[model samples]
Target chain A: MKSLIDFGAVKIYIDCSVKLAERNINHLYPSYVLEDNTVPPDYFVSLKYGGGIRRFVRKQVLFEQDSKSHFKPVPENHAYASFEWGLNYVVSNYAQEFLTIHSGVVANNDKAVIFPAPPGSGKSTLTTYLMGLPGWRLLSDEMALMLPETSYIQPLIKPVCLKNNSIDIAKKWFPDGKFSSIASATAKGDVAHLSPPASSWQQRDRVAKAKAIIFPKYTPNKKMEIYKLDKNQGFMQLAENVINLSLQGERGFNTLTHLIENTEQFEILYSDVNEVKDFIEQDLL
Target chain B: MSKHKISSQQLFDLLADSQNALDLSDSDWVDVIRIFRSESVLARFACQLEESGVITQLPSYATKHLANAKLVAQRQVSSVRFECAEILHIAKNTCEKLYLLKGAAYCLASLPVSKGRTFSDIDLLVTKDVLAQTETSLKLHGWLSEPLSKYDEAYYREWAHEVPPMKHSGRGTVIDLHHNLYLPVSGRAPKVELFLEGAIETDGFHILRPAAMTLHAIIHLMLNDDLKHAFRDLNDLHLMMTEFSKQAFWEDLLDLAHKSGFENELFLACRYCRHFFKTSISTEYLTKLANMQNMNQSEIKLLDRFYALALSPKHYLVKRASANFAELVIITRAHLKKMPIKILLYHTAYKVYRSAVESLLGKAFFEKSNS
Candidate 1:
């Protein structure tokens, strides 16, 4: 079935062939994207796979959009995951309206905290946990979309992709939290999507002002330690996490500099969730 | 699904003059945006609307997409220049001459067609002699390539126009270093010097002259089996013909075609350029091409059956039911025209065998395709 999802600035029309893909999407998305014929989508994506003997032997799913496949095929079980990843590629390439950054975005009291971290730095894991906390909403789990020269980050609310050990940690922490079926043995092992609170989806159209930029790194058996970044160092560090700055050019550069100048930049090393929560409530709020 | 009544002719007309978008309904705009984006020519359409000062008249949603597409393409214009400079910095000592090709050439030469052009990666051309030294210099730097398997490597070394793409390790920018226009195999390669004769240096790098570049664009569109960029390539030809057309250009192109032994391709190029864009070409040249290719009216109609479908956007929203069959025919036709029958047969057999393996074991099991 072809469904059109309205994600604030972008509308994605997705058609899935496999039943698992359809089921995953229905469960993972905040609500059913009823067929809306009047509104044309910003992106048209489809998850398709071959059947017959290959279905049983070596099942794989292809993620296609814009009449081309931007990614390699993954196991059929990873159909929904493929769609998520493919959407990222589409936004970064075609939707230059949004200056996309490789970061996790969350907000409280309409103030957004940007977590710009490399892979395995626990960005998603921390984001997944924070989103489940009271009075906080998830703007995005994978990317922060900010219009050029704007301090406000547009909300692209979706399920956070938790991987490997973080998957179990999230499951243990939010026992009642909704999650999609786990896709095992992926490039990022044991991937699953954890849906944010319903309140987050309720305010999907709301844009949050840039409050602070935090770089999170997971250090086991250690308390939270915060290190402030100087404006120049902060500018370079935040700029490194921007995915489409090159495409955004001068305006994107100015936006990042303006953001770094206004916001406090910190690199926090933490293992205790409570310590991080206290710091956020004390300093950020 | 919405019923779309638009056809390939409609698309061609719109691309020929992008101002046609002004009359399009919202549903039609939807089709145009999706198809043009898929065909890698959305920026061209966006450029036309912006230039005509009619961009604001469109709905906000349509304008938003067009504006974004233009921004991306404008970014590439500068990026291409920077990438070209980086390439020269790395390989300048190893080579005496370098010619910018395709998108790089168009951008560096400041041609009209270069505006709103978007490229996947940078493509630059070096002579056959300096090809090795260029590769060695890039290798000493942080460039690496995923080696093709032995079977594919053997054929590539024998017939391919370029070496495997060398990507910079630190920068992650890809450079497709080319030595020839097509297959470098004896008796098949075109006269390289003929193109060089008209080349002009610009911004410390040489690019093919306007006429030569137009012919090369035709050759690229009409010869390559990959019709994925067919619409973009055809639009490129249209823009080039409109900008570079002159009495001398038509003469130089015909002369180059005959001497290069590609008059048949020249005729096809001319006919299709006229068919798609209604581009102005002299009746004299048309008659010359018809006589040169011995192209009967029926043959032209028959060729149009394939090119018309093959050249249209390959999106499900716009594609006809028989588009795949037309595409297959074009690919087969391209192979037959580009190679000898014996080599073509061998190539087909190898491809069939490889596909069978891929079907059973999955693709990328044996080789990570350079693309």
Candidate 2:
């Protein structure tokens, strides 16, 4: 089977098992291999070998793998697209010039800010707000691919998954934003993804050079502050956060050293997105 | 060199064709799909194979694994892709070129799309000369290395196969920086530069070719002091051999081993892979290599037993044997290195004590679970 989707000049062919009717609508041409098993309502998911199976489950679906596979009509125009979109990003990004990072990326002009923080750091919240700014693109809300070699950033324009109270916060913030049906009581607690702004999807493959590495912390009562971290300290912190630094060996070490030496680094403590965005724009821009 | 040793590209093509052509059961088909989709080149190859009528269907399993692999690859590729595009606009931008290694490299060079293999941390290899510089660069971007004891850090810098594993602060990913295929401190230090010189470069990254990589896998299993995960490494070696055997890889195997001072290990690995997976190789050629290495009957028998225990599906007996065998090898090698007699004895006693404690604790835990 052959499926073709045009990402501007790039054509992506997704070889999947089920047909997608919305192919023509979004320029997503899907050539699906017909399968005997029934398609489940919630698409099945699994981790491939060598794709970091340690972090993610090998198989995940709303239902069990052995259970009777059944199809339910996907709610038209939902927040998340087919699972194939996620797969497309994986194939297109791995082993390219980029290093897959577990962080959020949002940019204005070519100047992008990479927010690398642990969970509950409000990185996504900051990213969503940054995307709303004119001329700033939302590269990713969950993962920001850092091209350590060239200090470039790749956009994984997927839905911004919000959890717990952030869901309501996002809905109120972007009243026009679409969202996936809320999946409650997940391992990460109640979760929903803010529909990627249509523009974000259109610029999914846009590469940005990161200007600042901001470690965001959301302490509700803390005053908004953006402190410049020393270059050596920042490099050490960033190295600690990179997914494949060690795997890159000496090159990883060199690449990371060069990246840290050149880029400005900061630690942001703020609950207000507007305050954080303004501070980053003033300091970084 | 025989005509049988295939280039990496040719091997990939063969696997793609085989994946498409085989009339495999669903489970087997899934495995093929997983392999194809985990590596980007493989995925593209599979798609081409499909275009050429080499195989039918994307294989459901391919889609399943691709989803997660895709996510990880996206995270890595997007950053670099962006950097490449925006190079002119950025100031003082130094290119930190990283070569993907192991499964991570396979994702880019071989897998159909990025989603075929679920990856946690992207594994990469760079030259050792730039180790300090690279660590400094990563720190600037909010990544931090895990704190290591001075002794451990010195050990990694001085003699280990790779730098101590580094953890990402934001992503919770681990990166392992390797300077050599095996720990340099080992008694049997193979020629590292020969392997480095023979590395195949792809998409701005360098990687060990199939034969060399296979040998590295063997050395990793045998020499590493850490035995807790020996079986997992053994499984990886088994799977890699099974896949590579389909191609014309014998010549590459022989040439790599002879050049790298690892002819004996190459022979042993081939022998073991064949035993465990029923993989086929040129037996006459392997026997010739074994004879040249002067491997005695006793050594062969011992290696064969070790291989059996390593690959056995039943864990109970195999685990114990594996632990004991690993200890014996380490202790014997220490003695051979001319360590003081008292020090060697102390190390042996320590191993015995640790093994006993672990066994007792393991038994107690198992019993508790059963109860």
Residue by residue across A122-218, what tens digits does model 2's lDDT show? 9878887778768888887766666656777777655577788988888887887766666556446666666556666666667878788999999
Please write out the lDDT profile of model 1 over residues A133-205, one tens digit for every residue.
8889899988999867878899886678989888889999889888889877777777898877888887888
Predictions' DockQ, in order: 0.40, 0.02
- In candidate 2, what are the lDDT values of residues B281-362, reduced to their tens digit? 6678767787767678997787566545443332221134364664556436534442345644755686576667645443
- Lowest summed lDDT over 10 consecutive residues: which window, candidate 1 chain B? B362-371
TM-score of chain B of each: 0.93, 0.61
State how far residue A228 of model 1 sits from its true place (Å).
3.3
Best by DockQ: 1
Q: After superposition, which runs of candidate 2 have C-alpha atoms over 4 Å from their true positions?
A: A1-97, B1-371
True contacts kept of 2: 0.00
- What is the C-alpha RMSD, rounded to one decimal, of candidate 2? 15.6
Query: Chain B, candidate 1: TM?
Result: 0.93
